[model samples]
Target: MPEVLVQYQAEIWQAIGETFIMVGVSILAAILIGLPAGTVLFLCRKGQAFENQVVFSVMNLFINVIRSFPFLLLVVFLIPFTRVLIGTAIGTAAATVPLSIIAIAHYSRLVEQALLDVPKGVMEAAISMGASLKELIFKFLYVEARSGLVLGLTTSIISFISYSTIMGVVGGGGIGDFAIRYGYQQFKTDLMVYMIVIMIILVQFIQFSGTTVSRWIDKR
Candidate 1:
């Protein structure tokens, strides 16, 4: 490590941890809630099982509205709700509230698009074989769309990292916040560049891993 890095190793590690916490929670929310929500959106579309225009329209509009907000404004707007839920609108934990909400909205839309890419023939065949909704999802739709799903998650995770960088507005410290404070404000230009390089490496690794896994699992 360079002299500058050696000087701030501990702070750098702590920032990394904070970034992980914020991004990890967002990932969990995306998987647990967003995945199902997207599935519901797909199912409720016209001519699919349990199709209901009202439900579809409501959900579609809600997701669109959430996604439409500029992220910084969204974070500021959600301060009151974040404080209510986390008892403070500042820090790593508090930052997770908005991160998770946006993650769900972001990933849910990608998931719906992924499922939509699944051939219509797959759905018809599943129905012909008397597959239950659960069976249709797990056995057919998900399997066929697994690669797209993985790619979507990969894209979402990258966006989460980008969003986490702005958490400093709420005192939510992460690598980005660390860079802005100790590196930029302190006039440590080299340190800021190093942090940016680290983020680039992290994103590259994630993209590579996600693509490899997607390819490995893809049957089509």
Candidate 2:
């Protein structure tokens, strides 16, 4: 056990860093793109602001198709684009392109759902006060839906963290890669257990923190 640790400690640390980087980049991208896309999605479906049936229909189909794809398959399927975009397909950075793309599509729906949870009455209240589209979206929609949106993001970030683990199969490097290579391939059961536990702890920490923050923000 000591020998294994000595041999692979560097690899484990490197993998942890890689995983954090991947998940962080993906989360940022998802928030940037998904929030706007989700708002558009919610407001354009059959009614609401800027409703264009054709645009909504087309975007709806596009989001659905992308979201329906399995994350692992999406990574593999986008190899060409990843390479073209990043000039490689086997590192943490390269893997992030596909991860972010999928994250955006997946979280966009979550964000839209969160926004939908806002009371129609709240929106109407803003409109009755002569709120412009900008005010409606930035203030009314977002303010009322802030709690749900935070939780949705909390859930998406955790999922993205899990997904980042699989990037190891393609040399993406992360704790998952460390587990697979040292734990599974080398039959180091203890190492695998440790890695799994670490992942769980990371997730639980995020969940607790997110919940606390959300409850604090959601003043009813």
Candidate 3:
């Protein structure tokens, strides 16, 4: 091992664990809340099964507003709310508040787009077969859009990892935070490069896995 890695192996491992916690929570929020929210958005569109212009407009506007904020600013802006919810806006837990909010917004838009890509004929066919709303979605819509959904989730996870990097501003230490504090601040350029390389490898692995799984499951 390089001198830098040997010197900071423990810290590096701790940082990785912190990053996983933040990203894991964000992923959970994305799937549990964002997925349903996107489904609702799709259902409420102008001509969908549960079409309601008012609901669609309000939800669309809300998502747009959330996504419009620059991520750094969004983190600072949510400090008070984070404190209220997590009892402090200065740690990994507090950082998750903003990460999760952004994850939901980010993943939801992609999910909506993925669902939109499903052919209208699929819906019509499901309805013609007397499929209920739930059955139509499970048996037709989601099935057809599975690959896109997986791809969107993979994309969202990458973004979440990127977002987690900036959490160091709030003392939410992760690998990025470690690099900034120990490597950049200390002028250890090689260390910083190593951290960046790790991140690149992590992202590449995730993308490849997601793509492979998507292709394997995709029927059309």
Candidate 4:
């Protein structure tokens, strides 16, 4: 292989590793927080079990507001909190704060929507069968929406990857940061192009794998 090609491959792999780390941490946090928040949102929705407009609206406003902020800006806004949590706000670990926070809001809304997509009759049948809230949650809602949840999770992972790249602005070094630092910032056109191509390929590979697995896991 060409010397430049070999060098690019090494840097590309390194950047990919960082991206994976950020996305992995964010996805775990998103699942932990998003699932419960979504469940609460669904339960509090109008005409559902434990319905409450006040609760639903409050959560709705909060989630929407959190999700609406641009990811890069959110990173800047969360610097203090990130530093407090990670002991520094300019590394792979610190990058996870914004990634995870944004993931929670992003995935929570997706989870809520997925639950809403579950047919109302399914819940009614469960209720008539004398199901408890726990039963409804574990068996009915999630079980029925398992496929959609997978897709939602896939979406969250993709979003997390994109957001993680922006962490470069704050020195949250990753492939993106490497590209910016050595490629664009240094005016190395070839390096910049290589990074862009690798990033695109990585995104494509992730999206393809995620979609295929999600479809396979879907019982329906």
Candidate 5:
């Protein structure tokens, strides 16, 4: 194993770098897009601050329809769009497009749910105190739901990592692609085991950091 690691150290590091690129870009994009989307969804829901039946229904339908598609199918389905946007649908950059789209929707729903968990009375009290919509959302809703939001982001990050692996199927470069080419295709069990171990360690670290951060912020 030590020999093998020494032999493939450069390739392994490169693959790891590619994985981080895909996951990092996807997660960052998701947070920027999803936070607003989820907040809008929450505010526009029936009986909520900005409730509008038509807008809520349309947005809800759109999100659910996209979410209902299998990730692999979504990847294939979005190929043309990805190609048009990124010039090709088969590299880390191309892969990032679909991953970010899916992550946005996924994280949006998560954010909406997290915000929903905030007590209704909290918002009402804020309103009674002459809080504007912006103030209410930023100060009360988001502050109260910060822990849940962090955990949701954590889960989304982990999920995107898994999805990045799947990107390997479509020629998207990452550790998964490397494993497929060297580990599975070449029947190198040791390589496969290495891939699994690396993924497990990465996931464990993410989970631990997320938990610690959530607990630290959770005043309640």
Candidate 6:
């Protein structure tokens, strides 16, 4: 067993690296897009910042549609669109396209929920103080609710890690592909077990770090 591990150690590490790449890039993109999307969703809703019933309904429907699709079908469904954007539909890069979209849709709702947790009075106070819209959002909403936002982002990232595993079905190189090829197909239960252990540890670390940071930042 030790010898087998030693022999495939490089492959194992490479797969881990690939998994990190997929998760990291996807999460970053999700944050960039989802944050604004969620902010807009929040602001456009009834009785909110820029409340527009028509715009809110449209954005809400779009988000719901994207979030409703299962990840597997989402990957398959995006094959054509993915091909158009990246010129191929099977690889880490191609895989990232769908993963990012999934992350954005997933995280946007989380962000919206987090922002909603902010007190209505906070907005009232900020506006009364003559705060600009930018100041109200960035300084008041985001700053005051930062801990919740962090927790939301942390949850989304952990979910992204799990979702990335499914990318193996499309020839995306990650721990999932590694496990499917060398562990399941080759009947190497040991490798499979190792992968599971690694994933567990990764999840634990993410949870721990997120919680710790949230606690540290939280004044209330």
Candidate 2 residue-wise lDDT, 1-220, digit = tens: 4666667788878888999999999889888998888888888887675678887788788889888888889889999999899988889999798789878888889988898888889878998999998999998899988888889889989998888988975678888888988899988898898889889999999999888888988976
Extract clashing residue pairs from model 2. none
Stretch of 10 with least lDDT, candidate 6: 1-10
Task: Tell me the TM-score of each prediction against the true structure.
Answer: 0.98, 0.95, 0.98, 0.92, 0.97, 0.97
Candidate 4 colliding pairs: none
| Residue-wise C-alpha lDDT for candidate 1, range 1-220, written one tens digit per residue | 8999999999999999999999999999999999999999999999887799999999999999999999999999999999999999989999999999999999999999999999999999999999999999999999999999999999999999999999999988999999999999999999999999999999999999999999999988
For residues 1-220, could you state the per-residue lDDT of candidate 6 as single tens digits? Answer: 5766787999998999889999998889878999988888888899996788898899889889988999999999999999999999988888999999988888888888988999999999999999998999899999888998899989988998899899987778888788888999999998888888889999999999999999999987
Cα lDDT computed for each candidate against the true fold: 0.97, 0.86, 0.95, 0.86, 0.90, 0.89
Expressed as tens digits, the lDDT of each residue in 1-220 for candidate 4 is: 6556576777667777888899998999889998899989999999997899999999999999988898778899999998898899888888888888888899999999999999999999999999999998999999989888888888888788778879887776777788888788888878878777877887788788878977887777
Q: Which ten residues in a row have the lowest lDDT in candidate 3?
A: 133-142
* lDDT (Cα, 0-100) at 170 in candidate 6: 77
Residue range with the least summed lDDT across 10 consecutive positions in model 5: 168-177
Residue 24 local lDDT, model 3: 97
**After TM-score superposition, what is the CA distance of residue 84 in candidate 5 from its true location, in Å?**
1.0
CA RMSD, predictions in order: 0.7, 1.6, 0.7, 1.7, 1.1, 1.1
Model 1 residue runs over 4 Å out of place are none
Q: What TM-score does model 5 achieve against the real structure?
A: 0.97
CA deviation > 4 Å runs, candidate 5 = none
Candidate 2 global CA lDDT score? 0.86
lDDT of 3 at 89: 96
Best candidate, lDDT: 1
Decide which is better by TM-score, 2 or 6. Answer: 6
